[model samples]
Target: MPIQQSGKRLRVPWLRKLDENDLPVTLPVFMAYCMVAGSLRSWNRIGTKTIVTLVTGDDFYYPVFAEAARFFARQIWDGQSFHGNVLQWSDKNFRHEAEALRDERAILFAPLSYQIQDDDRLLSDAVVPLGPRTIRHAEAALRRARLPITGESVELLMTEPWSRLSRAFQDRRDPLQAIQRLRSLPKAIPPAEPEAASPPSTLGLTLSDTHGFGSGLIEWGHDLAKDIADYKAAIIPWRDVENGVLISGPPGVGKTMFASILANTCKIPIIYGSASRWQEAGALDEHLKAIRASFEEAIEKAPSILFIDEIDVFGSRGETDRNSAYMRAVITALLQLLDGFERREGVVVVGACNQPDLLDSAITRPGRLDRHIAVPLPDAEARRSILKHHSGVTLCSADYKVYEMATEGMTGADIERLVRDARRSARRQSERLNGDHIIRHLRPLIKLPKAYVHALAVHEAGHALVSHEVGYAHVADITISRWRVEGDYRALGCVEYDVAADRPRTRSFFENAIAVCVAGIAAEIEVFGSFSQGAAGDDAADLNRATELATAMERAFGMGHTLAVEKFSPDAFARMRASDPELRREIHNVLATELERARSIIRMQRDAHEALVTRLVDADQISGMEVDEIIRKHRRPTVSLAKPERRVAT
Candidate 1:
């Protein structure tokens, strides 16, 4: 026994010293006992009767009932006098319950959960809350007691996730989980900044041996290290109080890396999962049970991070604990855990997901996820740096020149695959990876049959030649095939037209685009004695635009093209093209009229071009070396310079 405390301002007495086990087995059940007796006076009853002292064993039934009896005894019950008798325990106690129930004397209060097997010893007078597994037994017991229970009487309260968390899991024993989670002690604020950090000289880049999430990691150390320093200030105290963060992004972006780095930045342990995965548990209402355990552990661990990926999975529409209950139950549980989390603890909850729209409105409604940051796909600059990171210094050396030019439209995943595939190609060929490594890698993969490649190359060359010659688009390069990466739809045998996307498309520009679109089919037909419909996507897209231009030419410009006197309608071109096949033919004619004339000129040069291709392909690896050999033997240097860029444009 400890001595009572005494203070000058107030006297504090240490009364009866009781162990926690001395408390009732379940406090809520005891509370329910009080509520039923107190509430019985107010409930609408058949007769004016009052409930006073009702009990099963030695325990007192209604402590709160004493107050209700004094206040509402005369007002609500009107003319009743209630007994405070503890009847002897026997089979007839139920008869006493029946007599009271008939006149509706006392209200029955049921426990929130129970096992049917253990509840067999319970008297008939007792009411028990019915769950899915226990409802049949409860109903049977109600019949045996001769008590009339309403359909609504078997109401089940939602098993809250917080309900299962034990009051006991104060501090865990494991040290590894302790350090990794940065979880410890009782709300201690981190040390001051000047004293906290290791000296600046030692905080430089250190190699990491640990891997995460099986995805490729982006080293945003240079960019995000500064953000990390900022986060440490806003975060550490909140981490002491346990805060959460929302990281939003599209798929395959570096959001996961951002999360992993943030964990390392916070120097805390992180347990990552979807809300649903953590909610559902086994025979124990596993999810809710596990949630309770996890939260308790997190609190004990203190400075910990619970990373719930795909948060919107919880906050969707009409969530409840009934049928289709798993989603709703999980959401409800998460909300409870997140409730009242303020002023920063030593724990943090971080969530990430791609579909922000799918999340419940409650999540973003202030206070919940206070911060949302977008992690977009890497732009051209990020892509270049990513390439430099993946490629060794020797591969990126000045003489190598592989990454000298901007890699226009590659993803982080794409760049990773590019470096890996290129290295494999270099190994297979027994050649060192150098500037030409990518060019050779592109060869075996980006293949068409030799004749097809030649014709397609000519087709691409013609589009490039005419588009530049007609001053429609400046050609970037006339490559025989697209970049060597998989799933890339850039183009096969492409001539990239450099367009500033922010600028709007103009009239003469449309004319140049149409010419280039048609030149491929025109060149293929002229060289191979027929045309393949390989340019369908190009032709379809161009024809739709051509009709719009044709309509504008006639209606707006009044150039006597199609409908000479009318104002333009959005569907007018569509209706005309649908009504007359010749209209589509003529619209095609209007777009490609000049390009057809240019294709005839390329056809005249095809024989000489075939000689150039044969010489290049036979050499297996074409360069300026093969091009010069062909030019020296075939015609003259004149043929070499006959390309549209080298020639005088008319």
Candidate 2:
């Protein structure tokens, strides 16, 4: 049974010789197996009958070894005569499968999706990664078959060949299917150059007018613009000026807008590229080419800004997985390109991402994207400015403050969306856009239930009351939502605190902080006999903070039963929680103790808590001063802090 090409017999001279066994393994798959065998032989594992080989690559290649392992077993190794049994990761019971293969002289193939922690014993031998090297081998095999290699063919060969053949020739596996897939790649037409955006003079907002950006970032952009202008006038050297920065923030916080505004301020063109866009160009080789082209284009248009969005997709080299080798190559290429900009003046590289922590360290190293700026959620003033700019209106002072409060927790993009929707509604009714239009849009169509609102008010009031009494930190403000804002609406209210710069962070202070953290839940339970799900669901929720503080107290802070400090990195902290059961129990004990303390504080300040909740429900917000005045009027008793009893294992 020869493998069938389009409508004829497929012929790859080397693979044709293996047709006697009717094996379904394609040439690329065969070559990959050969590569693994070569590695095992090189390590001198010849007589070791039971071997474990872990293959890591994209999920697309899993079927090569997993589904067709029996075919591989039927075929003899080119030089080595010994054949062995094959055991795969079974969906039913992997532990059972491992046990079944233990005594037999078998070769177990674990796919990339294998859960390593569940069965660490399976990682007994070599890890065979099939990435770019595998593709290169496929290319070599194609060259041996005398196939023409063009850019389109190469792109298709790298990406589409495996995926397409896996679908089209599922039963009739053939190397000729790869060649056919490559040759059939549609040649992409070069896109025409887009007309440049309206110059800096015509852009909507100047750097000074833009809100929701870090002050340092704004100042840096202005300085760079001036430096570029000076350099054009031959008044300064490029070495004296900073050339790049990486802006990081949550999505819709105006990272992309910052780049545009910076380019407008600098009076230079901005070339935008993203990791997804580069990847869409094709596989590794083509992706690298696209990245290079972006840099070269920016250089050609000298004194321009090269903005790379979602740059974190390149990822850090420290993390290891199936994609590590591939991403390492990509990150290295980007670093070289960034270093090349040192010689080329006037190209300021600005990278943006939602997660800057995941970026390769070298990407933001000194003299590269040296200044890493975090763009935070819009502050009250910034939200006000964003509303004014987007709504294209000037409001009275009272109205300005109202809308400012109403637009709380909204990003610049969210504000713009609100304005756009409001304008649409006003136009549909044939009326001029007004504050009422914006306000109507800002408020949720279906109001939050009254019960939920009261509970939220009580929750926030509890936190504020506790913090004010503890005197550990200053209660900044308490706010409750009146508008349908973006993001997790789980948080109906929030209590912010400003810790004193010189405050002592003793064990008592930490314990007090933990009490304040659990106060919201305590407040609800005290007032309503139960609590809502608000305190526990999200990552940044109340219970998570309390748990983290409790974990830190026991594991890192040396404030718990143990005197020795066991330091762990952020990643290691998560692993410690999973591995150490006793540590978890100790953390539970800390939380339970603090939760009781929070309940006591809430009980003592019941009158003050009730008054504050009423005020918050009425105002939908209260200032720090207003909160203090309410607590004063309620005549709260002084809060007494006592040491908590820890449980001892008998």
RMSD (Cα, Å) for all candidates, in order, is 24.2, 16.7
* lDDT (10s digit) by residue, model 2, range 491-543: 66788898987765667778888888989999988988988786874447888
Clashes of each: 20, 0
- C-alpha TM-scores of all predictions: 0.34, 0.62
Per-residue lDDT of 274-326 in model 1, one digit per residue for the tens?
55445323222655777666666666765666666657545465533122355
Candidate 2 weakest ten by summed lDDT:
186-195
Kindly provide the TM-score of model 2 when superposed on the true structure, using C-alpha atoms.
Answer: 0.62
> Model 2's lDDT to the true fold?
0.68
Against the true structure, whose lDDT is highest? 2
